[model samples]
Target: MKIRCRSAVFAAMMLLLVLAPGVSRAGYDYVDISNPFLRKIPIAVPQFKSFSGTPEEMKRARSSSQLLAETLAFTGYFKILDPASFLFDPQKDGIVAPRINFKNWTTVGAELLITGGLVQTAGLVEMELRLYDTFKEKLLLGKRYKGALADQRRIIRRFCSEVIYKLTGHRGIFGSKIAFVSTTSGNKEIYTCDFDGYRPHKFTNNRSINLTPMWSSDGKWIAYTSYAKGNPDLYIKNVREKRGTVVARKGINISPCWVPGRFELSATLSFTGDQEIYLLTGRGKIIKKLTNNRGIDVSASWSPDGKKMAFVSKRSGTPQIYIKDIVTGRVRRLTYEGKHNTQPNWSPKGDRIAYTAIADGEINIRVIGVDGNGLIQLTEGQGDNESPSWSPDGSLIVFSTNREGPSRLYVMTSYGTDQRRLLEMPGEQSEPNWSPNIEGP
Candidate 1:
């Protein structure tokens, strides 16, 4: 079979440098993310100015403003203020710092404000965006971007990343992708979508049973188990090059997980008469056997620092989560309450691991500390929630759930709050693997 891959070469947007650095009083400490009961910052984003005043410009103006609001709100950090409640207008009033009125924004209990102006030409758009501290009455961030009109979302996302970093001291998850298994094409094939579930398209079209799409650490490759041939073999394909290698061992090759900051990965191979995890190179060469247990040992999840791995083992009578020190070869059980626990995913922060457990005939998601202390359920009584994957920033967890109906992708805060559906499509989706942030804008 031939794999078709299309790659986009993004030209850097022209940046108009007119921002003053030390004008705003607010600093990086604006939002304390560590707070369990963090308050959502109220932000007012009025309609962007249509400098051309043409119908096309006006249409994009409204859509772009709404997209900006939605993008920021998706971070679970901001509350978008209604446009009807705004006292100032983008058309009549000024968007610049000199001709702005901060009291109008602060009066409506908005601590932050974002204003934009857009101009469109034949095929390109030029936008100027500004973020302000309403109480301090100063410009916090300002930038001008020029790009194709179709690239409006990317331009807005770049600005949003800057907005988040200015406030949170960390770049937000704006350009990441999530890969999962879906039956949309009448078979269990691999599909991918943008971080917020936009632009979902099939990643694999083999019309076979493709499962567990795992992204490499560099976001350049994806390793998955495919029954395209006869047996369950591991296929590692470079997402951009359209070429790959196959690890068709003797019995079975499954559960491929990449090591952090390296070209190596670990997968469970049953070729040795017993299922065990083995570390392999990116090109599919066995480096060493990672486990030598009598029972089945699979589903390897690596810690952020690559010092430890958390996997599922049936060595303790029932399937449970276990952590292994890569250096010392010391293994310890992490979960004991559940009879069936699997699909362990280590958080990027290296503090917790999320896994799926079947309790009372119900499958749900749970998070446990690295030291096996704090065990809390993230989803319950909601239909089966399985395959929990953490975002690169460690702020959110994406998992597949059947709470409403057929299994679909859902995302929630790390603490399991603000649970919401990620996307809707024709068929069921499961086993989502989130990619790291793409290289550039």
Candidate 2:
């Protein structure tokens, strides 16, 4: 295939070409992510065949293939087959449909197969990837991409997104990001990383205490509470522009959560003597008070449709989660099993809420249905796990835990399986907020 480019100094635009014709998206029902007793599908990933014999081309071929497998395996849906047990050889066998041996893949119990090919010349890379169904001996998805050599990770992620959408009918989290607070520079500051905890960089250099970095519904802005000016204040800044508005009222301002599909957010502002949640515009203008109770109310999590909100309230003598109907102004307690239930995060599907619950001097993560039934504890006996946040698709939850050592970010399936650490840095990390699907560089 012929690859074209406009500029060498600037990053080249990736070109995608679909090789398959008239494939129905609904034809594949390999995964039902909502099922609790889900069995992982077995998939195989082999080294890509390099078209050029140069050492640089072979290095890219080996690394890109492994990166592809790692990206797909990060999702708890797949069991990547060992490359050492592969029967088909990329050096002698074909990476295309006509030349692939289906029996060789099926013999190793591979339900799905992926093959890749690489071509590099003059600092540009061209990749052709294909996904196959081993049993049916059919090509499920195929794409060709051409871009700069530096765009290897981005190119692989784009292909992985395509592969996930082909199987699950929903776009993957490869395009999303996670924001959290870290003490890497001897001060609490906000940092952003990719969904798989890659490319973590400091987002704020406030040189003071920063907490609860919340992403806007559009993913362009972040709101967090910083003590840079000597008081707990809410600062809303554009992620790329580094310009924002500050809500530096008389008292404390914290726990900012964005409303679904809107520019408004609910935050705990204590300009008054009492701590309560209030609705505010994107620019720090207060629209109205959302809660009014003698007990302290804060940490508001909105429903998917913005018709209701779930928050923490001490009105019932202890901190418990409560749900409020935004239309009729009716409040009802959602959690009664725990006295110290805080940090409630509503699911993207609006059917459940995940929160931090403290019981018997142990803090763990728990999820209960919206109707206050089916309470299940996710973490136990390891260490304190707090600040649970849901992925955009509601298939996974990211939280902070001190299970091994200092607090670090961890991700698990929605059903509380495949728990693993996401990233490690110089200091503790906490309060991870997952962002929505973003489309850009």
TM-score per prediction, in order, is 0.95, 0.97
Q: Write the per-residue lDDT of candidate 1 for residues 1-441, one digit (tens) a residue.
A: 222212223655444454665545465567787852267889999999999899889889889999999998878788889889898767789999878888888888899999999999877788899998888888889887777777789889989988988888778789798999999989999988999999998888898799999999899999999999978999999998869999998998999999999999999999879999999999999999999998789999999999899999999899998999999999999998869999999998899999999999899999999988899999988889999999888888999999888989999888888789999999999999988897543
Structure candidate 2, residue pairs in collision: none
What is the RMSD of candidate 2?
1.7
Residue 62 lDDT in model 2?
A: 91
Worst lDDT run of 10 residues, candidate 1, spans 1-10
Error of 2 at 314 (Å): 0.2
Cα deviation of 143, candidate 1, in Å = 0.8
Q: Candidate 2, residues 164-240: lDDT per residue as tens digits? A: 88888778788789999999999899999999999998999979899999998789999999999999999999998
Off by over 4 Å in 2: 1-12, 26-28
Evaluate all candidate structures by whole-model CA lDDT and list the values in order. Answer: 0.88, 0.90
